[model samples]
Target chain A: MNDKKIKNVFIEGAISSEFIGRSIAKHQTKTSIGAHNIFLGQVRADEVDEKTIYAIEYTAYKDMANAKFHDIREATFKKFDLTCMHIYHSLGTVKVGEICLFVFVSSPRRKQVFKALEYVVEEIKAKVPVYGKEIFEDASHQWKVNS
Target chain B: MNLNIKYFGLLTEVTLCSEETVPFSKATVSELLDLLFEKHPDLKNKDFQVALNNEIVSKDTLITANELALLPPFSGG
Candidate 1:
């Protein structure tokens, strides 16, 4: 695996659709990428104990999370043939119906991008030291555990 | 040894602080946790995993570093 720079994946709050659009538009210059696979994780308004979750306050062990993301990136590069990739996740509060995670993978072929995108997202879910606190409508909160 | 322990997410709520330093003679990660659990009984009821020097470790792993973190379940996308 190449010495891919350890990129910081966290953005301050919810990711805007405009930002995501610009990201895709920026990649058009690389015409070699025949397939582009994108994954966006949206915050859901879930109800528990009659309380509806209003937002998620995300936090992370910054150093460890960055290293884990770097490892996942290298592992993905080794497992799939790809042209380029970009991953962004939200830090702080992201309200329900907002975007929290965005992953984009491009390759010359569609099949490789499909497999690679899922692989990266799943690895991120299982490994990275990121946490989310579900803030309810009444201001009560609960810690979120990945299922 | 003087170890710096960090708490994240639910663990922070239990610890009532984000980070702290505790001095101990324990030789393994589990031993230190046992000491911490004794100090903060609330932590004993919380679910978490321990990481030493930025890497998750098993209970039996020896304390090879001074930086430790108590991490709650991950929920990132």
Candidate 2:
């Protein structure tokens, strides 16, 4: 049960580049980590029915989503030799061309980091109960579903 | 018992309220859903799964007095 808890993943709005840079900087002291893989999810301006998506408003069943993220984190650690993993996602409106999700994974070798990064991102896409409603240029909205 | 129920995402569009405490007798998840459908007819057609205490539960699961949320499909990256 001690391993059941995890760090919070939700950020109020879009994740900034400076924060991400600092996260990477903080890990430099750990000489054991040789390679790091980063995955940044950006909001795309997809055209739907002549309406262009300007922003995505995100919401989640936070308690459950965080728990699922913890499960994913634990599973990823068990499956790979990793130094550390950090995940942060936006909770509110993230505009077009904005970074919404940041996943950082590090390992002692390039191969482990490569494999582990994909596993964590894919697991989050499939399991986390977070919703995004796409707001169009004309102020219309539609719920987004992962393909 | 008065149970607390929460709705998220698209389901909140139908219920209009995110959380509510409603009176309920002991029942299965499916039966509680039926009551919800009666209150918000629009929810009957929405696609979602029931979670009791943060874990997704099947319709046959007995209703318990705890955190309950109706979660719509995820689109998160």
Candidate 3:
């Protein structure tokens, strides 16, 4: 496969349904793959004690985030023999129950896809320099970091 | 010499601004943190991860005055 065939870095204020659709279509890949796995992370509204999370204020050190994403893409390529991979992460503010990250990995075999997908998502969550502020309905907030 | 330091997330909130330049001799990132903590004791309570030129660095990594230093936590998606 062409090394440049896959799109792996995306930084946006808000991820749209259209973007996701385009990403999937861009693959246009037909390798008679046994299966494809995808993982979409959506923000959820939650009540923390007296505060109710209404939205998420997403922020990132762009230079660092981009660099980290690129490194991750390279690492993923080294670790997996996959057909293609796509990773999208939101920047700025994202509202509650919205998609923040979309990761899709496809391979000829189902087993590799599943393992690679989980590893990619885990690495992204743990290593990326994106910060999220949980904005409460009452106008109060708290920063969300990896736990 | 002076190093340009960037802040993010909780560190930004505590500092009340994003970036600043601080004078210092050549030192490791941990030493810089010690200096920073001495200047702004409030930061000690928050706990931050340091990065040098966008690459995450351990506390022991040496940092020069010319580099861009960042203190932030892991907050990616």
Candidate 4:
């Protein structure tokens, strides 16, 4: 939580399972963490006007998005008793059923991880200056709005 | 004053460009928006907020920074 570096939270494409597994494996050195919670956001193949979504193309105002992510990380640490946390969001094309967002939070106790993980995800959904273009199967697209 | 104006999300589609340097003599965010509306009339109907130097600000806030961004509703996770 004391880490103040402005970590880049963006990945060029979908987050792979192997990358996630590696992240977890690297945390073994920190035996102080008693509980870990994770949240993965997948691209849903939603239908609109009879057309199904095939993928989403993501973009962001990099400077502002990173700043917002940093603020959210700092705020979450202040609000929760978390041992560590990591967040990653996808940029560019992400196919349906692929992972676009990943949040990992660890704490010394079970309850803190549960609360901190949800808080971080909700804050990212509300505050980050990132955009998604939902591309339909017919190659048409529409801007995504978070409900 | 000359300012760096950035368009994001749907705003970029409306403007047909992502970022541009615009010269403005305005003192407030609302006044600056008026100038943009004249150039891109379609933007007047779009739902968005203005960020002055990376912070969301009210329309009446004084223009103190040389950078501004038009941000539509965020859909990030």
- Candidate 4 off by > 4 Å: A1-3
How well is each residue in B1-77 modelled by candidate 4, as lDDT tens digits?
A: 89999999899989999999898765899999999999999999999999986789999999988899999999986
Count of backbone collisions within predicted model 2: 0
Which ranges in model 2 have alpha carbons more than 4 Å from their true place?
A1-4
Q: Pick the candidate with the highest lDDT.
A: 4
Supply the global lDDT for candidate 4: 0.93
- Tens digit of lDDT per residue, candidate 2, span B1-77? 88899988788889999999889888899999889899999998889998987788999999875567898888997
Worst 10 residues of 2 chain B by lDDT: B63-72
Note the chain A TM-score of all models in turn: 0.97, 0.97, 0.86, 0.97
In model 3, where do residues sit more than 4 Å from their true spots? A1-10, A29-34
lDDT tens digits by residue: candidate 1, B1-77: 78899999988888889999999665888889889988899998878899976789999998978888998889996
A1-147 in candidate 3: lDDT tens per residue? 234433435566668788888877766666565567888888888779977788787877777676777777778879988877778888777788788888888888888898899999988887777888888998989988676
Model 4, A24-113: lDDT tens digits are: 998999999999999999999999999999999999988889989999999998999999999999999999999999999999999999
Candidate RMSDs in Å, in order, are 1.5, 1.2, 3.1, 1.6
Q: Give lDDT: candidate 1, residue A59.
A: 95
Candidate 3 - CAPRI tier? Answer: medium
Clashing pairs in 4: none
- Shift in Å, residue A47, candidate 4: 0.8
